[model samples]
Every structure is written in C-alpha cells, then in structure tokens.
Target: MNDTTATLDAPTADDALTRPFPGASPYDTYVHASLLNSLQQPLTEAPDEMGFLVTTQVMELWFTLIVHEWRTARVAFAKDDLDAALDALTRSRRALTALSGAWAPIAALTPARFNGFRAAFGRASGFQSAMYRHMEFLLGDKNAALLHGHSGDRAVHEALGETYREPSLYDEVLAFLHRQGRPVPAHVLDRDVTLPYRADPGVVETWRQIYTGPQHHPHLTLGELLTDIAELVTRWRSEHVMVVRRAMGAKPGSAGSSGLAWLQRRAARPVFPELWEVRGAC
Candidate 1:
C-alpha cells in the first residue's frame, strides 16, 4: 500500500476517540459514572457488604430502565402503535433478564457472611425500593398501602401517585385491543385504574381467541411479548427469593417483611394473568 494510504488507514493520535476532553471525559459527563460510583458507600468493612451494595444499586438502575420502557410501551399502546409498544416491551424483557442475572454477585453468600453486614445497614430493605414498586404498579399490581407508604416523601409520593392513577401497561394493551375490535369487557375497560387489577373471565376469553386464531396475528405477537416480559419478571422475583434463601433464609426482611415467604408469594403471582390463563384453552 502507498504511504499516504497507510497513513490514512492507521489510527492517528489526534483521532477524536483517542483525544482527551477539555474537562471530564464525554462518556463520564453523559453517563455520570463518577456520581454513580460515589453512591455505593457500604456501611461496614465486611467483604461482602461492598458486593451486596453494588449489586442492589445495579438492580435499582435496571428497574429504572424497565420502568422507562414500560411507560413508553404504555404510551405507544394508547396511540395504537403496536410496533413501538412491542419494541419497548422487548427492551424491558432484556432488562429483566439482566436484572435477574444481577443476583450472581451475592447469590452464594452464606447466612453467616450475610449477617456480618446485614445489621450494619439496619432496616434498609429491598422492599423499600420505590423504583421496584413503580414496576409493580406498571404491571397492574396497584396497592394503596404501598403508595401511601411513600406519602412522607412528597416527590416520590407524587410520582408514584401519578402511576397509581393512570392506566397500567396491561390496561392500555386491553384498550388497544378493544380499539382493534376485540371484546374486552366494558366493566374492565371502565374499572377504576387506581385499584388493583383483577383478571376478568372476559379478558381471558379475548386472549383465547387470539391464541386460537391465525398464528401470525399481530395481536398474538403482542401477547407473546407480554408473556415473555411476565415470565422474566417472575424469574427475577424467584432469583431474589433464591438469593435471600441462601443469604439469610426465612429470617425477617431488612424492612420488616416476611422475607422468603413474601418473595415467594410475589413470585407466584403471575403477570398478565389473562395471557397465562389463555394457554390452557389454546
């Protein structure tokens, strides 16, 4: 090759990717990695505490992304934008998978090792995570008591209150289907959005029709996407149970929850219940 060609092909010191920024790196500025690194202040010198703190913080970040995607999907459904809705749901499923995998760091901590750092944090439980609560609310698991718990934090209460009052992602999906001529029950359509959603027989029948109809139906694709998200969510909960079982076992949760039992109950509750119910008929 010619020298000119060789020079052009070779990476230069002045290349934008290799050049240093005038202040903080562009990536650091955009992502705020410095700010994030500063947040993990483990309270004890216990070796496991840092890992536990980092893992929990990482999970919180994944929760934020999942909530953002769910909200996007909800809006897309409201606008009758199936493709956009599916894209967002697909993103969230991947996030949930990663969220589940995040348990790896502390998954094997024995009870003794866990207790070494557990007492240091004192009542700061994963159950108190507002972001995770937002995910639950988005999935139609509205609990008045949970929302009320955040009442002392005006900003958090107001934000969660908006999600509580608005139709959940599932609610929007059913409305979108109704707009497409599906027979979603009028009672379900008109139900108070603030209340916890109950699985309606009519909704199950609607899903059954979709499952039994054309295999390539767009609505069927939507159903599968939702099912994937639901299963991943359940898997994440089950992994949480596993981690807690290994780390602390049957003990009370950091924030006074029933610990393993509470997590098991949550894992047992199916997401998008009608979709799961339709499987039997199909």
Candidate 2:
C-alpha cells in the first residue's frame, strides 16, 4: 500500500485508552491520590518507619470506611430496613477483616526497628485517632471522658458529641427489633444514649427467644450477622494487641497510655454483650 493509505489504515483502536488527561488522571482527581501520597511524611530515617506510617494511615482509612458503613447500618435499622442494615454491616465486617490483615507489615517489627522511630512521634498515639473513636462510639462503647478529651479540637469534639448523644448501631438494632414486636425492654429503649451501653437481662431474654425460634427467621439472621461483626471487631483489636506486644513488649505507648496492657483491656471487652449471653442459654 502507498504511504498515505498505510498510515490511514494503521490501528487507531488503542488511542482513546492511551490518551492523556488535560491535567490530572481521572483516578487521581477522584481519589485525591496526590493528596494521600503527600500525607506520609515520616519523621524518621529508619527503614521501617515508612512502612509503619503507611500501615497506620491505611488502617485509619479502613476505620473511616467501617464507621461510614456502621452509620449507614444504624440509619437503616432506625428506618426498619433490615436488608439495608445487613448489607452495610456486611461491608463493615469485610473492612474489619482487611483492617486486621493490615497488621501483617508491622506485626513482626523488632524492638530495635520499632525503637528506631518510636521516639520520633512523641505524644502521638493510635489511641488518639478520632476516626477510631467514631468506630468505638458506633459500637456502643461511648465514653464521655474520651469525648471530652477531644475538646481542644472543637470541631472534632462537637462531631463526637453528637455521636455520643445519638443511639448507637446496637441501640438502633434493638429498637428495630422492638418495633417488629420482639420483647426488648422499655427501660433499654429509654436509656440515655450518652452513657456506655450495658447488657440488660431483658435484652438477653429477647435474644434468647430469637436464637431459639425458627432458624430461618430474619431476626435470627440479624443476630448471626451482628455476631459476625462483633467477632471481626474483636479479632482486629486482638491483632492490634499482638502487634504492639511484638513491637515494644509492654513499653509505654505514645500519648502517655499503658501500651500492651491498655490494648489487652480494650480487646477483652465484648462488643455486643447480650448476643454472647444468649448463646449459652440457647
């Protein structure tokens, strides 16, 4: 073929796929990848510090996602939409699993490696993560003292204060069940939302009925799904403790908290109390 004919006939199929954007790639623009990359300014020269910072930041993102899903689930339950709530809970469960797996990179850090950069981040601790606190609040682990701790940041404190006053994911779940004619106690439904949730015998009995009833019931399905979320949350906390123990071996945590011991205590607390109690009776 002549040069003109050959050139015209040449494949143009891949041009659109390979075309460059006017400024930034669509993916970068949408995900703010440039901004995210700019955030990992590690303060140490330690080889492991970068990985540690990245892993911790990634976990924070996962925490944000889990909190978002939980809030969605809570709203769904409040609206009496069980299917939507379950879907959101399932998403959070997957996020929790991924969050636990995030420990893999730093899980085996030697004391020397950890010490290489630990002091670089003075007074900064994972315990002070506002997003993580949001996750805890959603799980009915409300602590007014913890809420007050963030008061120095007015915006964060106000936002957390709202979560403190609002019904938690578990609270909405129980209210949904009560609306469906389950025998959840009036006192539980009336309890102040600001306080940390405590297990009630009436709630245990309510769960017991659901557990013993028809296996295919929707309430039973909800119980199992909630149990799954709780297990995943506990698994993530336990993994955190394991990672800390390996890295520092009971050294004091940043921000003045007891490191391993504090994490151990947190990991020991049950996520949904009545759900577990109902199992023994079943």
CA lDDT of each prediction against the hidden true structure: 0.93, 0.93
- Per-model TM-score, in order, reads 0.94, 0.96
**True-vs-predicted CA distance for residue 273, candidate 1, Å:** 0.7
Q: For residues 1-282, what per-residue lDDT tens digits would candidate 2 score against the true structure? A: 899999998879887788888999999999999999999998979999999999999999999999999999999999999999999998988898899999999999999999999999999999899999999999999998898899999999999888888999999999999999999999999998878899999999999999999999999989999999999999999999989998899888888899999999999999989999998988
Clashes of each: 0, 0
List, residue by residue over 1-282, the lDDT tens digit for candidate 1. Answer: 999999889987669787877999988999999999999898888999999999999999999999999999999999999999999999998998899899999999999899889999888888788999999999999999999989999999999999999999999999999999999999999999988888899999999999999999999999999999989998888888898898888998888889899999989998999998888977
